[model samples]
Target: MNDDRRVYGTDRGEDPRPQPGRVYAELVGGPLDGQLLDVTGWTPDAILDGAALITEAGAYGPGGRALYDPFPGDPSRWSWSGDTP
Candidate 1:
């Protein structure tokens, strides 16, 4: 929801660098299985600046789903493949 831009080189001729972003969430309820959370925001060039998103030992929500709502991602915004979601 915010835009932050940074320059790479000392001179203005150099290209601009983009400040990274992250989405956090808190799972209300679900299951605790061997799942790999494919965080969709990051791309090839999107460097993982500080932490690793996915982990083996994950925390839980009210029922069981991983409490990932740190960045407040809206689950309704999630889409799927095949035709479309």
Candidate 2:
């Protein structure tokens, strides 16, 4: 995983300007496949608990969420687990 990767803009209408001190994780699979997640300040416990990332491209469409879990061997990577309503 490339820690240097940063999200300057997103389809969700986030600010296009680069944010300093922002940590990112590579999102693999699901609707957010190949996307970068801002995980700055996330604790190990939070990472272990995983995340339900909001995505308009999810199975339930807009307002749906895509579940992601941290890769055991890589904290900088998150693998898709499933989708939520």
**Lowest-sum lDDT 10-residue window in model 2:** 1-10
Q: Score candidate 2 by lDDT.
A: 0.77
Winning candidate number (TM-score): 2
Instruction: Give the runs in model 2 whose Cα sits over 4 Å from its true position.
Output: 1-20
lDDT of each: 0.28, 0.77
Output the number of the lDDT-best candidate.
2
Candidate 1 segments whose C-alpha is farther than 4 A from its true place: 1-20, 31-73, 76-85
TM-score of each: 0.17, 0.77
Write down the RMSD of candidate 1 (Cα, Å). Answer: 14.7
Q: Name every residue pair that clashes in candidate 1.
A: 24-69, 24-70, 24-71, 24-72, 25-68, 25-69, 25-70, 26-69
* Shift of residue 13 alpha carbon in model 1, Å: 40
Q: For candidate 1, which ten residues in a row score worst on lDDT? A: 76-85
**Residue pair clashes in candidate 2:** none
